[model samples]
Target chain A: MAPSDVNQGSQDDDVLQEAANWLKAGKKVALATVVSSWGSSPRPPGSQLAVSEDSTFVGSVSGGCIEGAVVTEALEVMESGESKVLEYGVTDELAWEVGLACGGKVKVFVEAVQE
Target chain B: MKTSMLDQILRDQEAKTPVALATELATGDQALIYYDSATGSLANNPEIVAAARQAIQDDKNGTVKLDAGEIYFQTFNPPLRMLIVGAVHIAQPLSRMASVVGYDVTVVDPRQSFASPERFPGISLNHEWPDDGLRELDIDRRTAVVTLTHDPKLDDPALGVALRSDAFYIGSLGSRGTHAGRTERLKGEGFTEAEISRIKGPVGLNIGAISPAEIAVSILGEVTDCLHAKEKKAAA
Candidate 1:
């Protein structure tokens, strides 16, 4: 599928629908959901992002501090068809570079979109 | 399977009913859980079904780790609704304030003149009698009913319907003397003291509000307080 399809569907509705659209378009997709969040997290739990095999993404797991990392992880999960839970926090080594300065933690669960 | 579950969830979202979808992350197996008596489980797992039902009742979304696998319970409940029983002076600002705070506001008054779109601007208005209007609105636990008519004939029937339903907040505009009289009437109509006490007479937080707008603020504030107060109780 074209990268524009991913972009267009990203802002359409919820992340689940975006992922479903991408899948129906024959795009390999993975889903990243914020399963948990600590203090000061911009989005609450159950927030999601849809990531295609081509690295295009939709929605957000963080305010903007961690989408790139989640996309990278999601691409890897798409390859292996495996689910993994990733954690990000202010105490991480790359926290400053990722802009997680609000002293909070979030856990994102990423899985290959397979029905 | 995902398509079926997603379709069901989308249907439930459109219908504005509380629905819980649980997915086993490991196997990608999913189920739709409805707490209602019929067809309660889709995944056929009792424990997971119970967890989903509990999540819906608690009005929360989270994960439940079972021996079978980790199931993510995605809950979709409709937005709260505020039904203003009278298109009186207070409802003008109250409807606006309620909408600002994320309530699907609907004003019901049989008086067509008072219930005009000119008075309410963009609100959903019902020009039917109070009881019939409330019946059509289908009050639920996520609904809040406020009667501002102050007229016993209009307010009483609305109050009877609201009190018997599962509306989270039921308030009526009246003074202390009026409330006392209302209590007697409700008692005479077979309402127990416990049920009658649920009505917040002199509706709204006692902020000494004077103007209609001020009273609307106090009422919205009290409605918010009631909502959160219920949440606190559920959390505890």
Candidate 2:
């Protein structure tokens, strides 16, 4: 898909639709939620985006800090329909080694969406 | 043969039943599901199917996005909850605002003085202790909790619950001084430096707000900021 298409579908509503498409197609899917945020947190507690088996991006839990990780986590839940919690900051190593440079930390919970 | 989840939320809203939206953020199959009081945790209810269709239609017609064909929010199980820890002055307006924005708002407080259905107007009122009351409401990633009470009696316990609970947007209302006091109290109560940091003190954007209504706007603004910032990062 083109970058523009990805960008265009990145809206929250559109992203949800992508997830819905996957569910309808009987593909394993997962949902990620931002349970907590601190510092210059990008999203609030309840902001959401959906993704699908194809890695077709839809919604977002974090801006970019952990999308890669979230995708990986989502895949795991998608298959087993289990729920998991994740935490992230500006930089993974920095967040772990020193502290969150952005001052805020976000906790995301990923779960397989049972439809 | 199907009503959409979005449609069910609408129906629930109209019927004075509460419903929440669950969106998936990563690359995996995502779908929207509604939690109902009766049917319990079933997904793909007729309402969900219909609402999903309408939500997609709204995206197609709405200016948010097009050309991308349609917009679908992710799918998740029921219990996408929104819990407000205080039904204080600002909460009245905040509840109204959240509803207009399509959030299912539950006004919770142990104080009868602050939490009343009359004061909250269209919002759901829960007159239970903050910690205990949260049990009735769903606290999850898709759920956002905001504390509108400035009283320690109300705010502190809610913060304690929120810190340990999974609800998102755990913010309290107060000035810098009040927030500082809260920090001290949370620390005294044994919250780690890290946990206390999660609280958005002097809550909302520093937009020089002074009224409950204005504060409501600012609070939601900050909440959106939290929401979009994460989304922006994810997209990048």
The best candidate in terms of TM-score: 1
Compared with the true structure, what per-residue lDDT tens digits does model 2 show for residues B102-179? 577899987787787678777778888887787667476656788877889877887888888765577887889999
TM for every model, in the order presented, reads: 0.68, 0.51
Error of 2 at B85 (Å): 2.0
lDDT agreement with native, every candidate? 0.79, 0.61
Using lDDT as the measure, which candidate wins?
1
Candidate 2: tens digits of C-alpha lDDT, residues A20-105: 67777876666666645555766655455566787766677666656777887788777776566677755656335422445567
What tens digits encode model 1's per-residue C-alpha lDDT throughout B1-236? 34456556667766877777777766656677877731323457788888888877776656667977777776766667899999999999999988877688999999999999999999999988999999999999879999999899999999999989999899999999999999899899999999998999879999999999999999998888887784346434
The list of candidate 2 runs beyond 4 A from truth reads: A1-115, B1-80
**Runs with alpha carbons beyond 4 Å of true place in candidate 1:** A1-32, A37-44, A47-84, A88-106, A110-115, B1-8, B26-29, B33-46, B96-104, B117-124, B136-138, B175-193, B206-217, B233-236
Q: B228, model 1: CA deviation in Å?
A: 3.2
